[model samples]
Target: MELKKSSSKQEEVEEIRTIEKPIDDSFLITWESPTDPKNPKNWPYARRWVQLVIVSVFALLGPMASSMVAPCLDQIAERFHIENSTEKALVLSIYLLVFAISPMISAPLSEIFGRRILLQAGNVIFIVFNMACGLARTKAQMYIFRFLAGFGSATPMGLGSGTISDLFTPEERGRAVAVMSLAPLLGPTIGPVISGFIAEYTTYKWIFWSTTIFSGFVFALSIPFLTETYPKTLLGRKARKLNKIEKTLKYHTEWRLEHIPQRKLVAPALMRPLKMLTTQPVVILCAGYMAIQYGILYLVLTTYPVLWTHDYNERPSIAGLHYIAPGLGLILGSQASGIFIDKTFRFLKKRNNGKMAPEFRVPVILLGTMFFPTGLFVYGWTAKYHTHWIGPDIGAAMFNVGLMLGWRGIQTYLIDTFIIYAASSTAVACCIRSLAAFGFPLFGQTLYDHLGYGWGNSLLAFIVLGSSIITCSILWFGGKRLRAMSDMVIFKDE
Candidate 1:
């Protein structure tokens, strides 16, 4: 028997050969053919886009909730009798703490159980606990509810990236990953804007309540529409279905069977993200740069309300509107990255004998390196001197544009590099960035207090500038070599 290759360009579905196999034999169960409709990569553009939209919406909810409370931290602080900046920031940062932790568990589990279940379950958990956050009367209740809700929120962060990896090929992933990623960065910006007005006009509790309500609608949409896409899990299901037909006879359950003892699979699956983080240079550098970018983004977001409300003497409502500046910039970055990343990949692929490596994604971040620090320098100094509000907003928009480009580039590169274990690789990145996001804001007030906005932000800007250089150099000059040495297969476009 001869092995059949995929027609779409990569050997993505090698197990899914054209020739049929006996389920009772040792052959692996897979899609019927290269063009099998069941294969998500082969899904029609319309169908895949629907999945992208649903997951992106689910993805948006988590990061949105993470920062929605930013505009209303003061209101909550007052209600709970909290008196310190750290504690006030705790109300927001506690959510991010778990946001860093849950992806390790969720991403690995998605590899085991499938993506749909994790996405839906996490959303339900978010809806219930988020509503509880709105209902909480004490700081204790709010903290617990927020932490649990964060776990729910972050589940989609890893799941969404894995889903995009499952649904799109390396060539088509630029646009898909851009949309999937826009949620987390863009969500924070969108969140504060909505909550600022709600907290000013209505009760601060409405912030959680409104998101919970919107989450309910998105949850409902996910229930009927979202389906499993993990190639391994789908193969397992297909094998089980075949097994039921004739129990007395054997099936080709030996190949990629899912009946492995949970004891055996769980520990390794859960550990994979940590293992990669410690062992893989590509993962470490991608996550490191991303963490710096994420940390600074949250630091700015947490303090944005104060900048406008205190420095500019604006009301909470008007202060909240400033998020739109960064929000639009984030959109601009994502759109621009989406447009050029694939084109760049194709151009590079042509230059390199019609083969594509994950390193092709790194060039977009070079543009990010330029914008991120410049925006930081401008925003920092302008806010320090109390320049017109528009000056700071423009600076914010510019940095945010950099944030999106850098973030999308790294995320898509990881997904492409570790195609089979995309979820685990993504979890590693999420875990690191979440930690940064959590820690950065906790010290943001103190940093600004000591150094003032200009120097403090400039410090962050310079750090990211340095990190971007290391990130680009490694990926551009050494990414292919690093990936070649990796134990996992490095997917390439042919």
Candidate 2:
């Protein structure tokens, strides 16, 4: 009897080997070879980019809906006869609340069922309920519709990182992750700009209707093109096909020939993001820093109106234009960081004698740590002293640039570190970050009111500095030691 060596670089080979029986050759099933074109990592660059665009579009729709209603809150309140400020805000915050909760369920399902079904199905749910939000006549109805739509919206956030991992190697994922990660941060900034004009020129209902229409376009476009990328799910399908073609007298199904761990919640195929959150230190720090960055992004979204409308005496439509400042920052940051993160990773890999670790991703965030607080200080004091409007706009752009750079770095690091469970790790990160996005704005008005814009932003800047130091230090200095201890990590080296 003879044995063959599985390819060194193939994930499918690694998965099959993990579950291979030493004594029996009868049970093993795997990809035909390292270069199997069906393997998503082996997919042509054009096809991979198509998947990235589709997934990124799907991911963009969620946050677009989340913040699209921001400029329309007043109109919504007037129509619903709502008087409480908190209740008015809940219409937006409740969506984020559900966004946090639903991913715990969706991420694990992506692991089992594959990415395409969950993503498309989730978009359908978002489309249906988001349109309902436009039709709602009462505050309670608005809250319910928004929450349900958010449940569906969360699917992309939970699963998109894992899809990038599926299609690209660690060396190539940095740029792909940068584009996908930009959607969530950039969407909120761009949302208010669109909605502000709509609310000013037409009915607030158009905001919801407009987003639903765009989402429908995205949903329909994705149907024929998007395909499954999960290796376990793909391999299982391959095994089932082989079993039928070979006409095996003794047959075994994918359920019994498992190469991945299973955890059941309400369904046998479902797993929990909470399990990953509780156990992984890399996830903890990555999610925490991302959360802080997310919280700051939303807080800025809330405060932009105050600076432009009340302080500068601009109309709603005009004030909305300020969002472009941050929007430009996000685009610039993503493009610049995209090029450098991959270069940095390859450089560090060469230095380490062709070994690569997730820690290489952490250095990019050093640029973020500096920009994050400086942007805040500049924005805060510029607004505080009533300097030229361009001064604050520049500051806002700087802040957004920082947020996105950090966001892309942390997300790529998590996907690389927990390669097999990228969805689960990303799901937990979404859970924490969504909570921050929800909670931070609830206090934005009060924080700015009590301390004034200068001091309040300075406070946030200080916190950003502190958190970045703690998170980056742990990852840069101690990440390898921690990976050695973590069972959850899959690509321990590359």
Candidate 3:
């Protein structure tokens, strides 16, 4: 027993010796090491911007595919001999439904295989099915193709944030995010406009064909430029290179390729996001707010045609052009948010003694809440009373501005709060929001039919207003307490 105990103690000491300790001397910080060059954050700005553009292109393709089909839904249904408008609407919104569930798999896969591989693979999947969508002859075929395309398209949604975090420091992320964020919002708004013109001039199938061509272009462009950006993946590569160098020099380094546990790569990749989603209060609150905001966006999208065509007697082309107003709002709002979010973060960092907290972004949410109900009331009442087309357009623009602001605030807050697990954290919020986007439109027509546009929209506005107020209040007071309790923050401190 005494011999065994001595051997165990000796083994423990040897293990401790193998682990490298941090150098305390400040002079060592100035040394330029091989590892320094490999860090993505230190990469040339041109390379970083190229990566940003590639990921943004991937992000843009998904939303374009989603909404491009909107203008052609009637023609698609008629060709298939399906008469129900609600069922036809399902073909368009069901893609978003598939998107909600796919990230569960894709998010984990990105963590496992690396972001670039999954992104490229997903783009291929999207392109194939998107082509199938053009060739779909039956309603069942269309639904299946759209669902598969959506699954493929979900890759960029979750991976874009992780990529940004990998490549940019938190302080520099705002502008990159601004460009990336524009893709998804602007894609949907512009897709319908372009598709409407195509549908009017040609067959409905061209809508799918056009997106297929776009996706092909993106895929070709991404092949050379896209590279793995995840930290674990990059670090593993570095460790391997270091191991080879140590062998050549006949000197042992502290980091050993054999010492890295296989499970370290697998376990955290799968469990971290799930843990963050289930455990974090901030994630829960932000997710609920995002779900409501996305729901309202879809509600308006699904009902706009009903309001414009039936109530106002506008042509499809003209009605589609109306989307441009909201597109303009989203662009302007996103650009403004990029500037303000960074500025607010810096100001709060200074105020907090140079320590930045996630709660600093909450002010933007308050601003968004104020606009939420006001826009809804304007849109609802104007359309209900048969007011001029410009009135509803203005209302949509206002509502979209609020949506963009709220989205940017919540997204940045989540990323700031859970830097290590932001991808999974954002995934949870996105899942809930995508589900709402899918479900809200299904019932939008029914609610408008019975309650009329005015009262129905009023009810929606009230719900959003109440939720927004509650969200703002919670962030204002509870955010500080919650941030202190967060595991990510605790981990960072240690």
Candidate 4:
């Protein structure tokens, strides 16, 4: 009996020693160590929430910079002697073009370098270029600086959702996503309103100067708070630290003479998103739908100033206030989506024997599609007829509501489908949407001129409604089959 007891104690000691040894280089371990405080998932709730808020603030700054100049476009045109409205709108829209394309470079870089570093670095670049915008002496300088600033700003747009995914579980992700998602839409809405008043009180230069100052403050705040959240990068750092300690301890041991193996970084980490973009049918469909919806939004935004100032004879400040209607719609729609997205997931999970498929997000998308064109039609007809101002505002609000709902549905669905590659997937979607934002406004003047506001907007509404209907129908019918068809769905354990 004593011998057996001794053997048991020996085994316990061996197990403890094994646990203390460094993990194998080949083993894939998730960040779940209960003692590892560096793991974001294990962070204190307040700290994690604060980190999320900071990331959201970074997210907000990008969109705010994008749209802050919208209210002051006329003044910019007059100052620079830009006679063409299309040329004036291009200065605003081209920033989005840069936003669309820059992510192709930035997203992959984040995967390689790490999120916090790239995000902070990008902010510095953005701040410099944004300040340059305030000092521009000509239209060329303004255009170039805006584009460069946009390129720097795209980092947050691509990585914000990824940051949330890194910290939150699938069940808790809805609220985090709600907050992250709100930043992009809310920034655009609030930017113009505040910028309008600022422009009214001061000069066009202050718009750029104000954003630069705000960005600098956000950048300063981010330094201590935003730690590296990428799992591979964190693990790599931990391994390096452990290696140094192990080497120091092993100096007196026989094992010290042998060479240590270095971990090989996977190239696929940089290439996976592009692979997914090319091969993933779900990504393609969702991206296409998102692009169309975003294009329509930008088209309306570009035309809004022209309609208010030229048609209604409203001053720049009052015209900018009109954006509030869409702002209200966006908030209402986003809140409703936050509640319903999870509810829909729960209902579908129950229906499918407690298994939830990503396809469950499709139903809300159909509802959004129905409202999209209806809102467009109302706004178009009301504006063309010179109807009551409330009519157009209500129409704008309804359209914004539909845009938010559809956007949230598609975004949640993509994240669910590609949780591991959610950032890149989102980046791909954002790229197309940003392209539309850049290009749609350039043509807005021509579209309205040829067809007038009524038919011009009506045409766009018809196209968007038709596209949404087709895309949603395809997803509603084929989504289950598509999910079943993909190896990703079969492999997903949670």
Candidate 5:
């Protein structure tokens, strides 16, 4: 009876979709009216928020999988009989390696297939492989399973920004993006905190199993929660429907251009992120900047266990609780920054007589830079001297405050700058940041071992300070000029 009612309801929707039209020659299939419910942008507040919540949840789970095992590394090393430090870290960073490459594929595939299918499909893939990680019999199995799970993880990271663009106008995007960005940003820091007590009390295998359980719940929720938000795909569906009834009806899009074969679109679309990374300085430089910040974050997270476990002699569960410091910073910073971002944009636009641009986000980002290195410096020295635990935690919190501010600003800038191509552009940024995340922790143990807490962390701080200042300044003063020069962006101040 439930199935019958659902099938009948679905048929009713299909009928409604086909109802509108005064057919004519060369009519473009678009929203029947500005208020059309089929249009994602026109969705009600309750529905849009539901979709956003689902995307954010999906986004969080992948990153959660990446780091939830942090407190259980010793157990994993024992089980796998791993001796080499690099290889041990590889067990953790290996997932991120696939995160770097998979988005380049997933983003383009979403462009072709639409966002809903790929995202839901990604959840299913993640569920299967993540479950495999729990049951792995060897190091080889662990590495291979982790690497495959990351492909599932990459979908939401790659395509989430495009979904935001689809559902909200530029003026309404800042808060939505903050919600989007906060999920993945805080996932790594919070994952261990949640899993830490579990690891202390139970087998490390629970990490993967519990995660799979949570993810399966999320996957069930996503089946009905998500919808296709890509405009081109929506319009294409409309065109197909109209064409079915009228034999002569033909709707045109860039995809239907005579010279560019349908099959050829796939290759260029797949390569678009790489092209943007190489040819566009704003993209490459901003991506590089974000990469540095992300690398530093993973470096700190991987090495944090060392600080507490060895130096401070804290239990694994207690050490896990310390992750809350950075996690809190992300939450507080994102909340405050989210509100200010839209207000700043609106203020800057008014001052410019109703002109709006990505550069408006630069001021908030600059404020973030001041806080990150300072946190690193404080965290380094406090740990080096073995001061009260609160000191280092305080510093960690401060650094993440800076991180949230800067990362959010850059993400919003990228979305605004590449609205139409947001998925591809964000994929480029995610690729670089994921690469950095993968490589950074491999050297984290070495950096701290050789230089000790103070100098090693100080070295990282200086690097972050330099990169943050240079890239942010360039984005502010010169971003407009660069955007004007890019073939992809059509900039108009007026």
Candidate 6:
């Protein structure tokens, strides 16, 4: 027993010494210089914009597929003999339900395999399952296909912001995030308008078919342009190339392919977002704020059919045209926010002697919060009194503007806060917000039915006003301190 103990101690000491030894300089992989051209951060402005445009287009296609079918839910319900209101709503809601869940898988996988492969493959999955949705004969089949398609569609949401963060620095990221984030919001709104026309002119199946073609186009463009941007991934490739060389060079990169873990860090990667969600107050508040916005957006999308077809006695095709107002609001708001967000951040940074904080973005959200309830009030009251059709449209458009502004603010904040883990952080935000989006519409018809648009939306406005005030206050006064308290990775300087 004494001899064995001594031998174990000697082995332990040797192991410790081995670990303490410095890694050879040759094995160390690093950028060649501060201005290395291969680094995404060093890419030319035109090239960076080209990458962003490609990603943004891919981003738009997924959500377009998700909500384009909104206008066809009634036709789907009648054909499938779906009588239960919840079941009818489930046809749409279930897609969102899966959307909330799939990011758990997709976001972490993107981190492991790099963004391009997962994104392109996920789009393909989305294409296949979404097309299958059109062919679904039974209610069960529709539910399954929609869920699977949603599972696939969620990849862009999970990964797109990370891609933006990869290409742009925090100082330059605001507008890029705005463009990437706008895709999902804009896609849902634009979808129903097109679907309405298709619903009027062609079979509902064409909706799925048309989107498939569009997504295919986006996918083809992505294939050639969406290069791998993950640093470790690029280094791994470099290391592999070095190992393949037959001659031993006197001077060569020290990076070793074997140093990277053979097994994917699956368990820890999967748990990170949930861990952040539970431990970080900033994530909770921002995610909750975004969720409310998403819920409201979907609520409007779900009820447009009811509002125009039943309340105003408009033809379905014309009713679909009304979605254009909100779509315009989204575009204008996003564009305006993009232009201003960077300016806001820069002006604040300059005031503080060139230091920027995530809290700097909160003021924009304050403006949005005010617009949120005011627009709701305008929309709800106008629809209640049977005013001019344009009244409700204008109100809805205002609400969308508020939504886009708030979304842009929070999204930029999240990407900035969780810079290294942007994908995972975004996935968490998307999860809760997607849940709100899923459940909100399930109860939308009933809420409007019981309370009327004026009172119902008025109640929503009050709740939003209260929540916005609280969110702004917390982030404004305590955001930096709260970030300090958490163990999550945060950049100390922009």
Instruction: Highest TM-score: give the candidate number.
Output: 1
Query: Looking at model 2, which ten-residue stretch has the lowest summed lDDT?
Result: 13-22
Cα error, candidate 3, residue 322 (Å): 0.7
TM-score of 1: 0.95
Residue 349 displacement in candidate 2 (angstroms): 0.3
Preferred candidate (lDDT higher): 1 or 5: 1
The sequence of per-residue lDDT tens digits that candidate 1 reaches over residues 281-374 is: 7788888888889998999889889899888999888999999999999999999989878898889888998666888898899988989999
- Model 5 whole-model lDDT (C-alpha atoms): 0.82
TM-score of each: 0.95, 0.93, 0.88, 0.86, 0.92, 0.91
If ranked by lDDT, best first, what sequence of candidates would result? 1, 2, 5, 6, 3, 4
Q: lDDT at 39 for candidate 5?
A: 74
At residue 97, candidate 5 shows an lDDT of 89
TM-score of 3: 0.88
lDDT of 2 by residue, 1-494 (tens): 22244444543433233333334545555444556687787788999999999999999989988988888889899999989988888888899988788787888888778899999999999999999998998788999999999999889998888898888877788899889888877888889999889979999989889999999999889989998888778877766667667765243433454433444323533444675677777778788888888888888787788789899998889888888999999999999789879999989988998676789999888888889899999999999999999999999999888887787788888887787688888888999999998999898998999999999999999999999988889989999877777777876454
User: Scored by CA lDDT, what does every candidate get?
Assistant: 0.85, 0.83, 0.75, 0.75, 0.82, 0.78
lDDT per residue (tens digit) for residues 271-304 in model 4? 6556656777777788889899888887887678
Better of 1 and 3 by lDDT: 1
lDDT per residue (tens digit) for residues 1-494 in model 5 = 01111221322222123323435524655556445688786788888889988989999988888898788888899999998888889988999888889888888777777889989888888989999999999999999999988889778998888888777766677788888988998899878997788778999888888888998999888877677888778877766666666764466433453224447678878888878988887788788988999999999998898899899999989999999999998898888788878899889977987657889988878888888999999999999999999999999999998998888788888877777578888889999999999999999988999998899889999999999889878888899888876777533444
Better of 3 and 6 by lDDT: 6
Clash count of each predicted structure: 5, 0, 0, 0, 0, 2
**Candidate 3 C-alpha lDDT tens digits along 258-368:** 245555766666676666667778878898999998888887876776677678887788778988988887887788778877787778767877555667787877777
In model 3, how large is the Cα lDDT of residue 449?
92
- Displacement of the residue 316 alpha carbon in candidate 5, Å: 0.5
Candidate 5: regions farther than 4 A off: 1-26, 32-36, 254-264, 490-493
What is the alpha-carbon lDDT of model 1 when measured against the actual structure?
0.85
State the lDDT of candidate 6 residue by residue for 286-383, as single tens digits: 88988888888788689988899899998778888998888888887888788778889889877987566888888878878877788899999999
